[model samples]
Target chain A: MMTFLVRRLAIILPTLVFVSFIIFGLQQLLPGDPALAMAGEERDPDAIAHIRKTLRLDEPIAMRYAYWMAGVVQGDLGISLRIQKPVGELVLQKLPVTLQLAAMAMLVALLIGIPMGMLSAVKNGSAWDYGANVIALWGLSTPNFWLGIMMILLFSVELGWLPASGYVPPAEGLGANLAAMVMPAFVLGNAIAAVMMRHTRSAMLQVLSSDYVRTARAKGLYERAVIGKHAWRNASIPVITLGALEFGQLLSGAVLTEQVFSIPGFGKLIVDAVFNRDYAVVQGVVLCTASAYILLNFLADIAYMLVNPRLRS
Target chain B: MTALLEVEDLRTSFKVESGRFQAVDGIDLRLEAGRTLGVVGESGCGKSVTALSIMGLVASPPGEVAAAKIRFEGRDLLALSADAMRDLRGDRLAMIFQEPMTSLNPAFTVGDQIAEAIQRHRGLDRAAAWARAVEMLRRVHIPAAEARAHDYPHKLSGGMRQRVMIAMALALDPKLLIADEPTTALDVTVQAQILDLLRRLRAESGMAILIITHDLGVIAELADDVTVMYAGKVVERAPVEALFEAPQHPYTIGLLGSIPRLEREQARLDAIEGVVPNPLSPPAGCRFHPRCPFAEARCREAEPGLGPVGPSHFAACWRTPLP
Candidate 1:
């Protein structure tokens, strides 16, 4: 296990470097010049030149990449051209909000999805199974942003039960934070839940039909015990893999959801940076999201070993 | 003495897309205390279904099991409530399946699986159940019973896994053990070893055994009484020696003849012609008429029921004496 972890970490370093290079190249290729965006409609060429020189935008692409890579190694993520502040500091400020939102969304997805999926599998052709399938289909088809808007209109505008848009940190009264987060989380979580439910149902259906489950039943175990004790653990392996992939997606793909809810998360920060031609902030956020994706996959491998002892060797 | 298990006119059918298919049709079985009853048949001839029906393990909707009477220890098993049947299973009645690789739960340790049965039926605590699991493993002749108990099914060989399954089934000391092709998936040596273990266990516990298999050699080796089935119906039943020495039904004679004999220098082994008919649409009269060499026009026109041929022997055929 120790050797496995060491090898995984070694692979992660090169992947992160490759990801950083891609993020830097993509940011550099964006249409708008960062120097001009910072200058903000200034007519003077001399002023634009001075801004470009200060930001080191005048250097060759390779030189600029080397400088950026060097700064990344030294824990300096460069300065945001629009805000004139360290990109690292900006990301640090917004990272918690995104993390909290993604975590809450995942929690909601799992709590509802797994049970619904199991029920669908157990009661295969029953009304509950049909109903869950329909709901899953709807959730999968509906865009998160559109769902967020609909939820806001229904729960916030019509019912006046939750705040329409915004965020509140958990430190400032748990109720208010949860109230502010509910709609956005639901919107983001619904699609993930649908995917989870479908994957879990298929996995469970396959496991339930296996000969071991028949043996369990032959042992005189109740249907509940057979499903829960014998079948659930084996079925959960695929679901865990799905969950890790969904979580990585949530962290990066929450841009439209964060936009819809007016949450000041990393997704929103990256979006604003794109419009403002803040290359450093864009590169920083991309690097962070990419690292998170890699880390989540690594954690999933560990979880697989824990769930299936056969895989330990 | 009262029989440990007595099943009469037991019929099991499945409702598939094509139509209703009878898997086990009008079968009768009896097992006396401490004795072995071998049910021999070709594949798809209801050998396993009869065992499952007795255990009430057949799934409904797709499959249904009905019988005139299924008495176990003087109680009507078919009339027991689902919960009552559950209590009987793994406690009063246990079963071991054919495929050991697929039968034992891969996620759990061999000890834990056996211990679960002990805990469920015997009401033993975890530690005591664990110890009993080791004891059961030892009884099955598995080496390093203590350490092997902690190993999962995947870590064990096919023979060892089957032994673990036997340990689990016997952990609660059920009065009746239904072994459905228990040694079919095992190697020849392992099959002999498993049969020996079962024989020893039965002698020790005085528990009745219902051994289902296609191998006549197995039946001859382990069974006191033998039942021969052809296409979901029992065609002949007699003592082991009578069935082998004076087989009645053509199906039974064919089955015996098919076994390769070392004494005979035959160019080829005798094989029963044709396959077991599809249960979905079996022959209108006799299920095995198409495959039977002695099948006549009357045999093809009407099904035959069991009739006395000799002492404690029965045969189902149009012509018992064969002219």
Candidate 2:
């Protein structure tokens, strides 16, 4: 078990390195030059030159990558040319917002998904199963942007129940923060919930039909115990993998939902950085997101060992 | 002298796209207390279904079980409520299945699984159940029972896993143990060891065993009485010695002849003429008539009922008292 953990942990470093390398290399290939983009409206040669030298844009691509990598290693994500602030500070400021949103979205997904999936599998071909499938399909197909707008129109504009746009940090009062973030979180989570529901349903269906499940029932275990314990434990292995990947997706890819709700999160931060040719902010955010993906996968492997005893060997 | 299990006209059918097919077609059985009864047939002869039906483990919806009476130790099992049935299962009546590798949950340690059964039925607390699980493992001759109890199902060999299954089934000391093809998935040597284990366990506990297997050798090994089923219907019922000695049914004779023996020097081993007829489209009348060498017009026109052929023996064939 220790070896498995160590091996999984070891792979994270090289993977992050590769991701960082790719992000840095790919940033150079974009159509517009960051030095020119940072030179302001005048298009002055002195300003462009100054910007190039200052940001090491004048250096060779490989040497510049090495510099950026060095800074990354030391937890210095470099300075955002547009904002004149450290990329790390901006990322740190935004991290909590996106993290909270992602966590809530994942919670919603799990809470709605797993039980629905379990019920769908248990009452397969019944009305409950059909109802879950229909809801899942609706969730999967509905655009987050449209759903976000519709929710704002109904809840914020008409009913006057919630603020349609912007974020309120948790320090401002927990209820207000939740009220503000809830719509955007749901918009992001609904799609993932659909995916989780399908994965959980299929996994549970396979488990419920397994020989061990039959063995479980033959032991005279109650239907609840049989499904909840014996069957659910096995079914959850695959769902955990899906959940980790999905949560990583939620963290990195809430751009549209964030835009619709005007939430200042990684989505807007990273998207704005890409458009403005803000290399430092873009590289830093992608690196952080990539790290999150790796860490989540590592956590997933540990979870597998916890649930499935065979992997401990 | 009384029967521990009395199954009468027990029919279990499955509803497929084509139509409903009876897997266990109104079979009757009576197993005396402490005796090992072997139900033997080719694959798809409904032996496993019968076991499942008796244990009340048959999956519903696609499958349904109906019977005149399934009495176990003076109680009609079919009449019991779902709750009552659950209390009896894994406690008073337990079962072990064919694929030991898959029978035990892969997620749990073998000991945890055994202890769970003990905890459920015996009402022992976790620690006491764990101790009992260790003891059960030791009884099944699992080496290093204390340490092995912590090991998962995947860690154990097929034979070892079968032992674990046996331990779990017998953990509650149930009155009846329905081992459905328990050794079918083991090596030849391992099969013998498991059979020996079962025989010894039965002797020790004196619990009636209903073993379902396709292997005649398995029947000869552990069975006190033997039931030969073909196409989901009993063709012959007799004491182990009598069935082997003076087999009346042609299918029984064919079964006996089919066994390859070193002493009987023959160029070819005898095999029954055809596969067990498909349950969906079984031949009219006697289910085995198509495969029977001595099949006649009368045999093809009407199904034979199980009746006495000798003292304490029965055969279900028109020409059963064969000259």
Candidate 3:
């Protein structure tokens, strides 16, 4: 297990480097000039040149990439051209909110998706199963942004039950933070829950029909025990993999949700940085999100080994 | 002495898209204490279904099991509530299946699987159940029982996994052990060893055994009384020696002939003429008429009931004696 983890970490290093290079390359290809964006409609070419020189935008693309790469390795994300502040410090301030939102979204997805999936499998072909399938289909088809808008209109505007937008740190108090997060989390989680539900249901159906499950039933175990102990554990392997992938997606894919909710998260920060031609912030956020995706996939492999004894050796 | 399990007029059917399909049609079986009753048949002949019916393991809605009477230990098993039947299972009645590789749960240790049965029926705590699991493994002649008990099913060979299954079935000291093609998936040597283990266990425990198999050689080796089935119905039944010696039904004779004999000078082993009929649409009269060599017009016009031919021997056929 130790060796496995070490090998995974080794692979992650090259992947992160490649991802950072891509982020830097893509930023250079953007149409707008960072210096001009910073100068903000100034008629004088002198002000633009001064801003470009100060921001090192006058250097060759390869040279600028090398400089940014060196800074990234040393834990310096450089300074935002628009805000004139350290990109690392700016991201760090908003990182917790994104993390909290993603975590909450994942929690909601799992808590509802797994049981509903199991129920659909156990009672396959029944009305309850059909109902779950229909609900999952709707969730999958509906875009998160549109869902977020509807939820805001219903819960915040119509019912006046929750705040329409913005975020509150948990340090301020758990209740207020949860209240502010509910709609965005639900919107983001619904799509993932739909995907997970389908995966889990199919996995469980396959496992439930397995010979071992029959043996479990023939052993005189209660129906619940047969499903829970034998079927569910085996089925969870695929579901866990799906869950980790969805979590990685949730971390980076919350751009629209964060916008609709007006939450100060990394996704929103990155989008804002892109429009302002803040090259450092975009590169930093992309690198972090890509690294998170790799880490999650590695963790998922370990989880598979844990869940299935057949894979351990 | 009374029989350990007496199943009379047992019938099991399934609901298919077309209509109801009878898998086991009007079967009668009796197993006495300390005796071994071997049920021999081809695939799809209801051997496994009979065992599942007796164990109440048959799924409902799509499948239904009905009987005139299914009495075990002087109580009607068919009349018992689901919970009552559950209590009896793994305690008074236990079963082992064909494929050891698929039957044992792969995620759990062999010890844990056996211990689960012990804990469920015997109410043993975890530690005590583990100890009993090791003992059960030892009883099944698995080498290094203590260490092997902790190994998962995937780590064990097919034979060892079957032995572990046997240990699990016998962990609660069940009064009746139903083995469904227990050695079908095993190698020849492993099959012999498993049969020998079962024989020894029965002699030691005095538990009645109902062994299901398609191999007549296994039936000849382990069975005291034998029941031969064709399609979904029992074609012949008798004491092991009588059934082999004076087998009346043509189907039974075909089954016995299909077995390759070392003493015979035949160039090729004989096979039953046709495949077992599909249960969804079996022959109108006799299920085996299509495959029987001696089948006559009357054989295809009407089904025959099991009738006495000799002492402790019964055969189902239109004509009792060959012309």
Candidate 4:
């Protein structure tokens, strides 16, 4: 197992390096002058040139990439050109918020979706199953941006139940921050849960028909035990993979949701950086998001090994 | 000996787009303690369905135990509530399925799965259950039983996994064990071993067994009595020796003739002429009429009821020759 972990880590390092190189190259390719943008429309053309040189924008792509790679290895992600803060610090400030939201949203989605999925599978052709299908269909069909708006309008504006916008760190109080974060989390997580529940239900349905489940029933196990103990565990590897992918997606794609709910997380941070042509912060966020995606996929593979003995080999 | 289990007019069906299709038609079977009844039929002949119906595990709706009276230990098994059925299963009755390779849950250790049955049905605590699981593993001749108990189903060979399945099924010393083609998935050598293990377990525990299979060879080796079914209905049933020696039903005769025998010199092995009739629209009167060479006008017009054709033997046919 240790050998396996070392091998996975070895593979992950080269993969991350490749991703960072690609992101660095692509950000440079985009038609944007960060120095000029930061200096604003009133700035003199000569001043823009001096700022660009200071930021090393005049360097060849290869030299710039090599420098950025070195800085990454040395834990210096460079300063945000617009904010005048360390890119790492800017990311760190927003990273925890995204994690917290994604974590809470996943918890909510799983806690609700898994059981609902199980119920749907067990009930199969019943009204309850049909209802779950309908909800999931809506979830799959509706765009996240539109859903976020509807949730805000319903919960914050009309119901006045949750805060319409803004974020509070858990340091203020865990409950207070969670209360503020719940709306956006719900918006993002519900969309994810719909996909998850469909996968969970199908996986469970497939496993339930397996011969092992029959053996469990023949052994006189209660229906719940047969479904929960035998069917669910075997069904979980797929659901876990789906969940991990969703977690990665939620981390980066909750921009519209965060904007609607007015929370300052990585999603909003990246969006702001892109608009202001803050190349350093943009590169930092893209690199972080891509790394998270690749890492989560690796974690999902490991989780499959842990959850199902059949996959351990 | 008083019968340990009795199934009367046992019928089970599945609903399809066309209509309800009977998988197990009106049939009766009786078993006594310490005996094996081999239910023989080709695939889709409803042998597994009958077994599942007996266990109350038939996937309802598209599958249902439409009509049957299953009596185990003088209690009406089919009439029992779901909760009561749950209690009876694994405690009084257990089942080993076809494809031992697929019958054990792949995610759990074999020991944990066995212990789950022990803990649920026998009420043994975890520690005791684990000990018993290892003991049962040994009973089934799984080498290194103690270490292998922690291994997952995928870690075991097909033969060993089937042994684990048997150990789990027999853990609570069930009164009856339904083995649905337990040896069908195994190679010849492994199949022989599994059969031997089952016979020994039955002898030592005195449990009645219902062995569902298409292999007449298995029936000859392991069964005391055999029921030959075709198209959801029993065509022949008798003591194994009697059925093999003086097979009365034409379907049985065809089946016996089709199988290659070492003792018989043959120009060509006889193959049954046609497939088993579709269950959805089975041939009227006798379902096997379409394939039976001896089938007559009367046989095609009227169904034959099972009746005594020899001492302790029964056959469903219109043209039985008298002694």
On TM-score, the candidate that comes out on top is 2
Q: Estimate each model's TM-score.
A: 0.97, 0.97, 0.97, 0.97
Better of 2 and 4 by DockQ: 4
Give lDDT tens digits, candidate 2, residues B69-120: 8999989999999999988999889999999989889998888999988888
CAPRI quality of model 3: medium
Kindly report which residue pairs in candidate 1 clash with one another: none
Global fold similarity of model 3 (TM-score)? 0.97
lDDT to native, each model:
0.89, 0.91, 0.89, 0.87
Model 2 misplaced regions, further than 4 Å? none
lDDT of 4 by residue, A1-313 (tens): 5566667878998899889878887887788788778677788989889897898889898898888888887888889987799999998999999998999889878986798888899899999999999998887798877887887788888999877778888888877788898877777778777888899999999998898888888888988899888999989888998899889988874887788788889988999888888888998888888888989988887887788776566
Pairwise lDDT winner, candidates 1 and 4? 1
Residues A1-313, model 3: lDDT tens digits: 6677678779988888888778888877899877777676654799989987877889998889888888987999998877778988987898889888999899889977888899999988899899999989998999998999999899999999999998888999899999999889888888888888899999999998888888887778888888999899899999988998899987774889999999999888988888888888888888888888998999998998788888765
How much is the lDDT of residue A245 in candidate 1? Answer: 93
lDDT of 4 at A235: 91
Of candidates 2 and 1, the better by TM-score: 2
Model 1: per-residue Cα lDDT over A1-313, one tens digit each: 6677678878999999889888988777789787777666665789899988887888999999999889988989999888889989998899888888999899989987999899999888789999999999998999988999999899989999999999889899999999998888888888889999999899999998898988887888877889998999899999999999999988874899998999989888988888888888889888988999999999998888777878765
For candidate 3, the per-residue lDDT at A99 reads: 88
Docking class of 1: medium
Which candidate gets the maximum lDDT versus the true structure?
A: 2
Q: Could you give the C-alpha RMSD of every candidate to the true structure, in order shown?
A: 1.7, 1.5, 1.8, 1.7
lDDT of 1 at A57: 82
